[model samples]
Target: MIPFLSAWPPSPANPTLPADELHVWVASLNRSQTQLNQFWQHLSEDERARANRFYFDHDREHYIVARGLLRQLLGNYLQLPAHLIAFAYGEHGKPELAAEQATSGVRFNISHAQGVALLAFSRNREVGVDIEQVRPLDDGEQIAERFFSENEVAVFTAVPPEQKPQAFFNCWTRKEAFIKVIGEGLSCPLDSFDVTLKPGEPADLLQVKGSREAAARWRLENLEPANGYAGAVIAEGREWQLRTWQWPA
Candidate 1:
């Protein structure tokens, strides 16, 4: 089983954990081309064609590899058979285990960007995660003005031009993570909440207006995914700890 520590590595004021203990893994989907092709070869012709139709080669490869890694990590940590870990989807396409499995108490969230994917697991809390690549933006300010709350727009407008993309992505991921946590999708207005995501810092909940119960019940974390990506995770409850793990290629 994965090691469980008595306490998490302090807080933002304290140093982050060693890279290894952060439980962050990175895979170069580019490097997995051969393994992906082999996986395809094993599938029936119809299944292969279905994958081709539903996903790009890279996304298909990512799904296959990520699911395998999630199973491996879950099995190692929970001692549960990987095959028995059934999956169900939320109204918004957020994938989760069935009520029976969920009540039995395993929770996880997964997100992928570029060639890398992330998986987070917890035994006693609801979790959700999102990752996005930092891309050049032609009109980030306009987009923020259109979709962000007044306070969020103020924060975005104040960021230096060079830092705007990262700031934008950071906010986007945090919002997505929170939405996913509630399984509410776009039903939650993007402008109704605000998250603080300073560089090299943990995410802080700034403002949440609609559901008082939700705001009080969930904890959100912003992650620095490598150097070029922004990521976030939201977990229900306050007593849980986060432990990131890396996957061996």
Candidate 2:
């Protein structure tokens, strides 16, 4: 039911949506040399350096493609050259455009797992997006017991055996996205909040400790980026509508 991004390679489409809408773009890093070069040319010098730091060539290329496309899309929205976009990191290492150079309260977050990446943008609200490849978990229950809130652990244990892998990632991505939205990274304990994980349940933030009312303030929307991966977006305000797209490589 999500609308994939209609834009293609070389040029990105400028997204125009209502004030309360959140736009999400997903892309695959499996690109040809030509596409890789296109993304690399748009990246800042620092981004290029970061790309080179990865130990594996595959990892290096993923970094380059992820960042290059990020800058390209941001530039399209801001009407600036992609390489010129400057970034500032939050206290917990979340990257954001430098306040002085950013306009219209434009904000974005990116997450890539395996070969897939998801990026989400919102005008004024804090936003976080995460994508994870659903894979086998050798000690799923043990991990859940250690990190999940008591109620979340209860829910996790209740799911039937066949659904554990998807359920585990569903919970993980939801928690990660919320932490990113709050700009707290690992500083915000994962067990402090609750998220829904059962297969048929809606993707949602169910509760928040200390800040008991926060669960209602943030909204979680489920995403299916590819066949075996799961993705989600968490935005501070519940009023926002979500539009998903498949960004061109």
Candidate 3:
């Protein structure tokens, strides 16, 4: 069975969530075949098909483990068995529950970079999360200038050379989280808004098309899921207390 780190059998009797809290679960996707097989037992047929579509064995294994973990968590949250959980996709391929489960008030978003995965959950509010492995990038600056907003580009340009790699991912992950929160995916223009990208700077949305109020409505928090990897979480409200945990190895 996939194991949670601790305290994860959330009390169903007291399922009412605090209005000001969010939970982020960080886990590694790399799993042994035996573990992978156990996870696969919880998957829906459609998910299995998608997993089978991956050409590489590792890619397929990762997909199964990721979806399996997702189902397991949702099951715990909803007090249901893992395979009983159902998912429906949004217009932009964002996954949601069937209309029957809409009243549960559990909002979540997922992102995986390389082998690390992040899952963000909240009650009655939109949430987004992203994780990315840090690696050498020859065209990091060029890509930033082309995609990041003007103000964001300025911030990226001002960062010292040695710190650019981390700063670039900082900006990229924040943008990705926001877009996922909005459920627009990449259909929304990356350059339409700005986000904090410099090292040592507080994580913030900065500005969304110069609307300070719009910017203020969102919150960004840096995530350190593992060394050599960067993560971020953005949501539609402010001052939401964050609680994060990792899956058992």
Candidate 4:
């Protein structure tokens, strides 16, 4: 099992990013006004403007904190001041470090929900991370049938009623992590791939529809960010080791 360590590094220096290691961080988005103000300093003007576009105050605060923390974390890895980090957007609105800033080939992805965020980092490999709070959905099964692959729908249908929520999120998070890894967003057909959703089972991308080779090229794993949350992370290759860390540790 992956362990989210509570130990903070002693120094503010750049952390090593090994080619064969993937780092995942769990962060709490809730912060006091003073702390939130400090995090705000890490944002770019564009990011700050985007934060302001959120409809809810809580959402706006969370976006600010999440973006700020992302910059801070990338700065640590990139050995630059947080404010100096630059980001560029992909065609699908996915964010990546500006070309010059990413010479080391460091790639990352972020996902957050309900005041918690998951950030993933890797060197020279694509990575995606997703976290969602486990909540009851009235149309959970219908959603499964509509989006999950045929095999996934069958498995999800067989899950006990009390366990459906967990199974639904397991499938959702894994599928989302895959899309993020590919940077294709919703245009990637959900039913075109398959992922394991049963609780207590190992998370895996069992098939990628037509390409067995594509399915073998990536690795997927389950994440338990917090008590009421379900998460998953996928990376380009199966060789890297995963390390989990807690923010503000």
lDDT winner: 4
Pairs of residues at least 3 apart in sequence or in different chains that clash in candidate 3: none
Q: Give the clashing pairs for model 1.
A: 22-244, 23-244, 23-245
The lDDT per prediction is: 0.66, 0.84, 0.83, 0.88
Clashing pairs in 4: none
Assess every candidate by TM-score: 0.77, 0.92, 0.92, 0.94
Tens-place lDDT per residue, model 2, 76-108, is 777789888899998889998897666658889
Backbone clashes in model 2, listed as residue pairs: 5-245, 5-246
Show how many residue pairs clash in every candidate, following the order shown: 3, 2, 0, 0
Tens-digit lDDT track for model 3 on 63-100? 89888988887777788888998888899999887776
Instruction: Report the number of backbone clashes for model 1.
Output: 3
In the order shown, what is each candidate's alpha-carbon RMSD?
7.0, 3.3, 3.5, 3.0
| Candidate 3 Cα outliers beyond 4 Å, as residue runs | 1-17
Task: State the lDDT of candidate 4 residue by residue for 11-112, as single tens digits.
Answer: 334468899999988888888898799889999888889988999999999998888889889888988899999888889988888979878788999999
lDDT of 4: 0.88
Q: Which stretches of candidate 4 lie over 4 Å from their true place?
A: 1-14
Error of 1 at 197 (Å): 3.2
- When sorted by TM-score, best at the front, the candidate numbers are 4, 2, 3, 1
Q: What is the TM-score of candidate 2?
A: 0.92
The segments of candidate 2 whose C-alpha lies over 4 angstroms from its true place after superposition are: 1-12, 210-212
